[model samples]
Target: MRFIFLFTLISVSFLGFYNCKKQNDLIEQKIVDSLFYTQAEKSIIFSADSTTPFTCLSALDSQQLQILKKTSRNVKTNNDTTNYLVHRMYRTLFQNQGLTNLAAPEIGINRNIIIVQRLDKTGSPYELMINPKITQHSTSTTVYAETCITLPGAYPANVDRYNLIFVEYYDLQGVLHSEMIENQTAATVQHAMTHLGGGVLPLTIDPLAFTGQEIDSIMSDADSIPMRIFLTTIHSDSLILRKQSIDVRPDSNDLVLMTLIKRMRAALATTTGVGIAAPQVGINRNIIWVKRLDKTGKPFEVYLNPKIVMTSSNTILFNGDGCLSVPGVNGRTQRWAAVGIEYDLLDGTHHTEVVQGTSSTNFTAVIFQHEIDHLNGILFIDRIAKLLQTK
Candidate 1:
């Protein structure tokens, strides 16, 4: 009788311990699931493929849902779906007028969870990774999660942006998790994408600002400028070469803008020039292509609506200030040794950069001054003439 009682007690204890463990695991899983789903609902909703429509989670308010609906209609009208989606995504996600700019969505997982995924222009999915460390203290659980996008590219093409999300949840035990996903094929394709000149050039033009005839004229003029040719004073294109170019407004025709950029870059490549401006090709818009000697590899970059906002008191007389517009004239022009410029990229981001260096080492400052002068209807020879007059 004593042996039977002892065996029964042992069996009861083992069963109780096993049941307790299973219950605890169920509670922990409930906490994790609640946190992950709730956080994902609060985050930006992304479509896995182009055919999938953009959606909003229940966490979004009615106003946000309405905004998303309106944006969706606008996106549908655009022919270039990928580019339009990218533009609209940035605007809606970061700069929506009516929407509050919330922090990036946080996710807590004992293992790994897919927070969000996006399809690139080429229809390849971008993978996201989140690393979270969860700690439990008595009744509450705290989670620290960091998110990163594994860019589809090789070394150096890979870019890391951190601290995008943070997660917290309660009633869960301590758990640590980390995961990494890499795609070399995607990365290589993405790396190639960076070389494709510009980003998100809007196609629609403001009809109110451009009459039908004027639009046709501008388009024709832009198309007439061949990729291999530079409009020069030697070719009787003096009116355009000497005119002060207008600002490239948000309402500017994107087709004209893109055509001018492509043709100007092509024309600059034919010469030994380090920079070329839109007026040099007879279009007369505030645009320039400059070789950034300051950057690694000396990549040629396009700047829209470039303006020199500040100049150093010190000046350097560049010995050979030549131009593609004024071909036969090369003169010593006084240029600022360092200059601060306010310019816009093709992606609509404004940047104020201060470039400084001598004629030999970093010639970027001189390049800025020269190209901006073209936009202002001034040439290197004109600058030399002014210097002579002052002397």
Candidate 2:
């Protein structure tokens, strides 16, 4: 993942037009005159570009004067999902011209795009079009200190923007309109897009690719652990992953799963342990190790072949999640706070349940989803974007 330098290209004709701006007209240069660049602020990725209108926003949206409000637009339960959203936003956004090359990214995320400089029919340096989300909004906008990953190790430029921007966007169906947002949400949306070229706003270029950081390492007691019932217990080393689903089941995979249920019953002697998966014992399987968190503190009731069916549109992102497989680490993730799931128990019994709330912390969703990836042979590390991420 490379830091995409979107505005790097300039047509020979534009060089005539790209004369130096007057001192007072520059965003970063203006900040420097204030003598406000602190040591910390000077060592980050931060900058801004000019604005290019996509839809000709209504210059007369009366909502601009109101105070900023908050919403759940960009909050995701895990880095994987966050990365997914950012990546798609790029591919969907197109320009009228200026694309010299369009190679797809391997560790792809479309949120931040690198626009190539190309000549239009008139032989002038014009940007391909850019579509940016309204990440922040309020009736009144202000720009503040901003950073970027592309221009690494630079000073943050103090800037101002609309307290809230009523951004116009489309749904899966393509109908378009605007939305208002406040505070950090608004700022983040604007900052990520400025890196594309034109529509100059204060955004920091992140040469760094992935967005996740290593909050901490998960700890484990030992390497090889116990095997569950319904499935045969294999070592993590023994598992062969192909993609994101389960590739192999044990000789008596169903029995191995049942054994997990029995263990849940035993572990439930005092409280619910619900279900168990092979990976909990150091083996990786697409299977789950979950049991409903009993209302009255019942033992964990085990289930097999669990699948989420119906779910509400409302999702939440929170922190402090842990996982049994990737031990010693916990962080935030985006998950459907409430989800409906239908699955089968070990005894060939089918169960329908709705996880109306989060499994645990944001990290819990990461872990559960991580385990699901195991079913298809996926890992958390593989999905991480190189930008703004930790080890």
The candidate scoring highest on lDDT is 1
Give the CA lDDT, 0 to 100, for residue 163 in model 1: 17
Report lDDT (Cα) of residue 92, candidate 1: 34
For candidate 1, the 10 contiguous residues with the lowest summed lDDT are: 70-79
Task: Identify the runs in model 2 with alpha carbons over 4 angstroms from their true place.
Answer: 1-225, 228-257, 260-276, 282-286, 359-374, 378-391
Whole-model lDDT per candidate: 0.51, 0.37
Per TM-score, the best of the predicted structures is: 1
Q: Which ten residues in a row have the lowest lDDT in candidate 2?
A: 65-74
Model 2: per-residue Cα lDDT over 286-321, one tens digit each: 356554443444233444455566666875654544
lDDT of 1 by residue, 1-391 (tens): 2222344455557757776766555554444343332333323233343333233222124443232222100011112432323333333333323221111211111122112223222653332222221222122222211111111111111132221222221111222233321233222222212112111111112322323433454466445354533446454577767888877653223565666677777778778889998778666678899999999999999998899999999998888888877768888888899999999887778999998765676789989999999999887888899888989
Report each candidate's C-alpha RMSD, comma-separated, in the order given: 17.0, 22.8
Relative to the true structure, candidate 2 reaches a TM of: 0.30
